[model samples]
Every structure is written in structure tokens, then in C-alpha cells.
Target: MPAIIYVPFGVYIVTDTVEIPVSSRVIGQAWPQIMATGSKFVDPLKPRVAVRVGLPGQVGVVKIQNMIITVKGATAGAIMMEWNIHESGQGSAGLWDTHFRVGGAAGTDLTVKDCPKLSGKVNPNCVAASLMLHLTPDSSSYFKNV
Candidate 1:
């Protein structure tokens, strides 16, 4: 089974973090957006991400497509995609046609981490191809999209 979150095309100002579980997806209708409400933050640990997904040990197919995430405050990264160790040999994940921007002076564009027993390089930012990840034991993931 696949998990999905759908947002219609529009502008939305938010002040909370958007977390995605294993096998979950976030879809945008045309130009759906997720933006922050504030312009700054007092605490650094507070998340400023418009969308977040997955954990270090959750293995499944997670997708974020056709969505725009904007950061209005200086907090966490715009989007975070995490990968974990998988022995099931049947897992895939991707981010398609997704865009991120920072309205504030501080913030990261994106962060991709392979933790809890995974190694190698993960290239998820490119303009030519989409990001594709397979969570298998002793496997590496390489993504290129532009």
C-alpha cells in the first residue's frame, strides 16, 4: 500500500512542520505550495521546513511531486529526505518536479541523509532526471534531476 497527501494549487502560509511517514507521499495540484508564516525564529531547533519525510529506519516508497516549499523563517532545511537500511528488498522513493525557495536570509535548500546503516553517495539534486532510491541491504542510491 502507498500513503499519499494531496494539496491543491494555491498559496498557504504555515508555522508548523510537515512530517511524512514511511511509504507516504505529498502531491501538489499544479502549483501547490507550503510556506512559512514567520520571517524569523528565536530557537534554532525549531523546524522551518515546509515538508519533511521519512525516518532513518523506515523503509518504503515515499514520493513528493509537483510541490513548492518556501521558507519564510530561518529554521531547518526546506525539505528533508531520509533513507534507512532495508532488508525487504522491495522499497523505492522519489521526489519529482518539486521546487524549494527561501524567503528569509537563512535556511538550507534541501537535505538528503542515508543513516542507520547505509553508505555511499546520494545525488538527489539535478535538472535532467528524477530522484530514485531503493532501500535494499548494502545498496547505494544516486539521484540526478534538473
Candidate 2:
């Protein structure tokens, strides 16, 4: 069985992170975006990540398509998506037609980080500052117009 989740066309305001479980594909309408409240400053030590995927023992394909992620007023984490590291038999993931923007704050940007999977390669400067999306080791993910 295949299941797909949809985010309606419009701007949604959120203060906390949104979690998408495994084995599901999240689709957006007209490039819907999730905007974080630009008033709160995230802690540099423990920043609030925007999206998280892959729960424990989740061995099904996951996808995120057609969306724009924006963040402002963040001290650290900013607008970022995290992929949990699996032990074995990991499921595949794909990102299509997605865009990430980091601006509007004093000094903040979007970022994607997985410490367990990408430990020694990811630039510490990217993690500490700026917006970036880093792929994992041996990941068969595809991206288009992102």
C-alpha cells in the first residue's frame, strides 16, 4: 500500500518542528511553505530543527516533494531537515522540486545535518552557520529543480 500526505496551498505558520513518519510521501500544493515565527531566537546549543524523518525500525520508502522551507530569527538550527541513521536495510529517500531559504534574521540560515551519518565530512562552518543540505553515505536519493 502507498500513502501520500498533502499540505494545502497557502502559508502555514509554525513554531515547532513538523515530523513526517516513514513509508509516506508528503506532497505540497503550489509550493506551500512552512514559515517559522521570526521573533524567537533559537539556541546555538540546541536549535529547533524544522523537519525530521525516519523513525526507529522504519524500513519503507519516504519522500518529500514540491515545497519551500523558510526560516528566520534563528540562532542555530534554523530551517533544516534531519534524516535518522539506520543500522541496516535502510529505506530510500527522495527530494523533488524543493527549495530552502534562510534569511531575515540577524545572522541565520537553513541547514540539514545528521551527526550520526555525516560526522567527519560535513563542514563545521556549514553546521555552525549558513544553509545547506548534505547527503548521506551511499544514499540513492534523487533531486530535481531543488
Candidate 3:
């Protein structure tokens, strides 16, 4: 049977990839933020995923709603969300009201103070992430208000 994972409003920090299995629904209340930090996601050449919807070639119902996926610290290799599940049916796998915020937040050090605009200087600490979402070649999904 499919499971419904409910994430209450809060700041969830992760240093590794968080994967969601097939045939599951993740519903977040009040747009919970999933922030990625630490050295785990620092290698730009070898990008890593923070949230993976499903494994490649997995076809099933995977729904994610009302969430905020972001990156903090020097996460230049962080791919915030990766959707790898092919929908079993039309509109079966989808994301609704899910957002990705790279920086300029409370925890993320990429604020104006750290990255001063037009400073004519590059700040490595302000490098939040390399990519926001990764929809793999074998993946197909539906997005609404995301």
C-alpha cells in the first residue's frame, strides 16, 4: 500500500540525499522547508541530489505538495529536487505548490550581507546550489503551482 507522509511546518536540514519511494504521497503543512547544508553537497563536478522522488524506471504514483526545498552554506553541487519516477497514469506523479529557495533566507548565508551586490568580488560562501530541479530523461511528472 502507498504511504502518506505528513511533514509539519518546520526547518528540516539535511546533509545527505532524502529519497521518496514509489507509490507514496508527501504532504507538507505550511510549506515546510527542506534545507541542504554541509560538505556533502560541495563538489560541483559531481552534483548530488537533496531530494529524490523515486528511482529511475520506477513508474507509480508519487505526489509531493506544499513544500519549500532550499540550500544553505557552500552547496554548489546540490540539486535540490530530482524527479525520477515515470507516472503510471496521467497526472499520477506530480508536484503541487512546491518551491525552491536558494538563498536570502534566515539560515542560508547567501544574504545581501554575505554576497553584497555589485561588490566586484566573488563570495564562495554565497554559493547556495548548482541546480534547483532535475527531471531525468526517464522521468515524467506533472507540476502545478510549483
The prediction achieving the highest lDDT against the true structure is 3
lDDT score, candidate 2, position 33: 79
- Which stretches of candidate 3 lie above 4 Å from their native place? none
1 or 3, which is superior by lDDT?
A: 3
Q: What does the lDDT read for residue 70 in candidate 2?
A: 67
Off by over 4 Å in 1: 39-42, 45-50, 73-91, 104-146
TM-score of each: 0.55, 0.64, 0.97
> Would you list the C-alpha lDDT of every candidate in the order shown?
0.47, 0.58, 0.92
Residue pairs of candidate 2 with colliding backbone atoms: 110-131
Candidate 2: minimum summed lDDT over ten consecutive residues — where? Answer: 107-116
Prediction 1 global C-alpha lDDT: 0.47
lDDT tens per residue, model 1, 91-146: 25566787655432233232222111243543323111111222334433322241
Task: Score candidate 3 by TM-score against the native.
Answer: 0.97
- lDDT-based ranking: 3, 2, 1
RMSD of 1: 11.8
Give the TM-score (vs. native) of candidate 2: 0.64
